[model samples]
Target: MTSVSIAERLGQEKFLAQTYNRDFLHVPGAFADPGGLVSFNVLSDLIARHRLEPPRLRLTVDGETLPQHRYAVPVITRRNTRWDRVHPDELHQRLAKGASLVIDQIDHLHEPVGDLAASLEGWLRAGVQVNAYASWTSTEGFGVHWDDHDVIVVQIEGAKRWRIFGPTRSLPLHRDVVEPEPPPAEPVAELVLTAGDVLYLPRGWWHAVTADQGVHSLHLTCGISPPHTGARLVGWLADELLASDIFRTDLPIHAGPEAQAAFLSALRKEVIGALDDSGLLERYAAARDAECVGRLRPSLPYVQGVPADPELMVRLTTGRARLDIVMAEGETVTRLTGAGQQVDAAPAAGPILHRLLNVGWHRLGDLADTAGVSVADTAALVAELVGAQIATVRSEGR
Candidate 1:
């Protein structure tokens, strides 16, 4: 998080607003130290330490997945067709040679990466997930293909040549009825991305990448701003109108066409009425933000409740945690956004949440001072969060 505004980092909002569905964008040299943001050594260490399985951790060439045994042998092959042992050295050598490596859901494996994704989601006002990709040679792993969602690409090391052909479909999705038409034979643009370059490619944009610059390349693709679909709208509506008898009734599958048509007509009215509200989108956005289950991590020591310790440092464990104010019984309630958790403190939790939401880091004493509460009380509150896995406390190495 540099202090750069979303609009500034994204260039002109109007430009994106206009061309968002029509074309692709390439912002070269966007970051000063892209490679430094995440370390390849750390990622390699994690993959080996965790023994992560794929398609989560797979090497691909031309849209085909290389056999796991090519690198990793099964120390224990299971009845479920899964293996426990994977060859890290062989996998590393393949990546260093030019094969594409995809580590899906990178956030789950790394804390810094997860935090960065959450921060972007907050800034962009949408959900974001980061996937890490690495390549060593001049082979196209996925070939010329389009993603179902928009991606923010950060080139971490070496150099990668990107041939951008732009988008053929308008706002495509993973579960859409129609796919985009084939991309043009010729690329619309060609660009070389080196360390620290950031690229934005809209969904349905056909592009190809290769490490032709003769160096190994590692990058993180932060997928952002997934669009809400009709299916989602209906799902949300069903949850909201669960109390309605007609909605809760079983479908008239056994009825005649006329009877079914009548049933559908009524359902349509209710669905349309729900969507017609001006606040529908905003409400959906909020609900989605609040319900997001971030990377769950447990905090040691504070197993029961937070101690009244003044020197403890606390930070949110989840990147997308929400803090809001609501009036209940003529008093304001401090509502924690994600996971629908809330606390009814003596107007003191408000300051704690304010500091939690806006600041990246907080010490127990500072939060207590802001809330006009004792350090011990603040520690107790933090302990509760730790128990819920929503916040973590760092111990000063004594």
Candidate 2:
């Protein structure tokens, strides 16, 4: 709801070290203009323009979903493709009667939410998905539940009550061997989130929410995936170890004890040597960052290449892009790695890469000026990145 960026709202240093993943924190009045972030009017636009259904656009009451027919009509196009076209009257009827509305992965559908998600992704160095929730009554939507990922809730308008019961298990994964115990009958904490408030709840925390303040409510939850764990490290090791013969060789399924023992011994040695490096974690993170499938968008109108148009805007679509310096033929070159591609550039382009890493769009002329590079060369670099899908270019409309 705030004009200030998500990173500013959440002081990155203090929150990450002292609280992130370990606890919950709530900041009141974090934003002043809640409507600017995401408002009732914006929700109306998204609902009217997009053909949403099921989990993407759902209506619920007391945690149970309303049937699709209750709020939308299935439309079959001439091509035989079908979609649920939302009927405004029926949808309003459901909302008026206490059903909560939810738009999942709204970041993809809405730009404001997308920017918020992107900023969080950049600062947290992890993926983020945002859902928009709106309610008109005290009816609960999902009941008391726990999410597999951490969330930052922004109350865009009105107020909502949250009952926190805490986590029954620590760091529960979506696909885990064991399920968490049921939350306690009584909540450990009860609070109301009003307009402009922000709340950070770690994954595995049990909580229930409702719009019980006699006013309609609209809020956004930016869900962030849990941090890389030891399990993730081992999983990554599996892929990295594929280059070694010990890992590539077939298992001794029918062989003698000595054969299996030797295979196991060699495997252990390889694994130990791989894990012995202190920089393994950093390398693993960098690999993941490079592969990040950022907000994939095609640069239309310029499919062939980007022209040297000074007013055009450009931005890196991925939040986890990594910029590194490498020695190339006795000279240092900058490597911009992201979205599954590595692009090596001249040293002067370092300034341009650094500028693009920041949140939001940058003008083509401005980026060129940042590095003192010619517009033609800058456009060439931008075209290469846009081709890779790690970054995007747009006209001055933004």
Candidate 3:
């Protein structure tokens, strides 16, 4: 949306030490024309036209969901359904009378927002999910709450006031041990975000938002992906260690104390052994990155292999898919990256993969000499990735 990079908005690694998770940040006029952030009319139209389902489409008020039938077609609310229990019609009436309307994960349905999210992933080096929240009047949505993850707020249109209380808890998780204490009565800082204004609030900070600016409000909250934690690593380690014979052995549920102690010692030794590996966590993160599947959209019409057209654009769907790299016999080696899997090519493949990875798209002829392959052959290789949905092919003029 704006030429301003995410690094510029949130600052980079050097700034991370000083600014991250410490205080509230507000950047005004981040976009040249702030009103162009998103289309409020289009969003409202989508809500009326589409049959938004639960988990995807939800209306929350005071931290509870409203029934679906009232918002959708005029029909009976299914008794056991999640929406029926929440009673959305009543919630809408309450919102019209000043209630907060929150729709989680709105990027799934919206296209403009999705494009922004993809761009952000390229900049942030991690996955990003955008949620939409709309409100009328001055009523607060969730009434003084803190999110478990950091958020980048883009005010699409209208205006909203934010009261930030900061966080009492540190790096809290969704399944946290204890809930954070109520925010202080007086806010540590107050901010009013106009269209195109951007705000960054780290996770665990207490904040409240309302469309109290005398006009309807619409905004998107882009949630940042959290760094890998020890909990995740241990969980992955447990799975990896299942190959060991001791780990495969059954628990000594009814065994004698001596037998149980021996069993416990064996398990601990195996767990500790895995932890001792200096590269274990790095390997785990690489594995996780390779497996991550970002939003995969279909490429219609040319369902078959991609044509060897130089103008056809391509990009990877997943942000974390690593390029392949491998060492070989004697002095020869291979380094492959991008387009899902990497292949050990002759020395020529290095420049080709390097070029493609460095830039979003390149002409087939451009990579032909570098990869030691013809333009058609390169197209076939790209087609393989397109078929895998890891890469996409878009015609230039269409």
Q: TM-score winner among the candidates?
A: 2
Best by lDDT: 2
lDDT of 2: 0.87
Steric clashes per prediction:
6, 0, 6
Candidate 3 lDDT for residue 181:
83
User: TM-score, each model?
Assistant: 0.87, 0.95, 0.80
Error of 2 at 375 (Å): 1.4
lDDT-sorted candidate list, best first: 2, 1, 3
Error of 3 at 183 (Å): 2.4
Model 3 stretches with alpha carbons more than 4 Å out: 2-4, 18-23, 34-37, 48-50, 75-103, 110-112, 122-126, 225-227, 253-259, 328-374
Reference-based TM-score, model 2: 0.95
Question: Over the stretch 1-398, how does candidate 2's per-residue lDDT look in tens digits?
Answer: 32235557777788788888898888888877777777888889988888787889999987799999998898999999988899999989999989999999988887767777877787787888889999998888888999999999999889999999999999898889899999999998888999888999999999999996768999999888756778988998898899998899999999999999999999999999998999998898888788787787777788999999999989988877889999978889999998898888999999999999876789999999999989999999999999888889889874
Worst 10 residues of 3 by lDDT: 80-89
Residue lDDT tens for model 3, 185-252: 99899999988788988888999888856577888898977645678788888899989999889999
Q: What does candidate 2 score in Cα RMSD to the true structure?
A: 1.9
